[model samples]
Target: MLQSVELASTSADVLIMAAAVSDWKPSDVSQQKIKKDG
Candidate 1:
């Protein structure tokens, strides 16, 4: 499973678990919109 939450309000242990949790994230993220410039 995956979750997203604010980091500041969370306790240390909870943040630890969130950090250690594993998920399939994309290998690359684009900084800007992709354009089909051919």
Candidate 2:
């Protein structure tokens, strides 16, 4: 499973039950970047 969230000012709670959780998050995301080229 994969999940993405804008962690600006939010709290998160995770529950663990005999499973592995691999979290991969970018260090920083550009706020003003061009997404397409034409």
Candidate 3:
């Protein structure tokens, strides 16, 4: 993501950053997809 932003900024006349900042980080992330039971 940082690389993309850097490359874009070089050619862009005006760079408008509209990305949101996360206040918190997740403690754990699942490696596999969780199955949902209906």
Candidate 4:
């Protein structure tokens, strides 16, 4: 994402981001890989 933003700044005059960001931290993180259930 950093590389993308840096590259875009060269050609574009302005950059507008409309993505939503989470302010809160997660309580628990899973160490194991999540399996896709089919």
Top candidate on TM-score is 3
**C-alpha lDDT values of all predictions:** 0.58, 0.52, 0.82, 0.81
Which regions in candidate 1 have their CA more than 4 angstroms from the true location?
Answer: 1-22, 36-38
Error of 2 at 16 (Å): 21
* Candidate RMSDs in order: 9.4, 13.8, 9.4, 9.7
What tens-digit string does per-residue lDDT give for candidate 4 at 1-38?
Answer: 88989987988988887755675566887899879999
lDDT of 3 by residue, 1-38 (tens): 99989987998799886745685566898899979999
Q: Could you tally the backbone clashes for each prediction?
A: 0, 0, 0, 0
Residue 23 lDDT, candidate 4, scale 0-100: 55
Weakest 10 consecutive residues, lDDT, candidate 2? 1-10
- Error in Å for residue 12 of model 1: 41
Task: Give the C-alpha lDDT of model 4.
Answer: 0.81
| Better candidate by lDDT, 1 or 4 | 4
What is the C-alpha lDDT profile of model 1 across 1-38, one tens digit per residue? 33344545365455444343465576898999989998
Best by lDDT: 3
lDDT of 2: 0.52
Q: After superposition, how far is residue 38 of candidate 3 from its true place, in Å?
A: 54
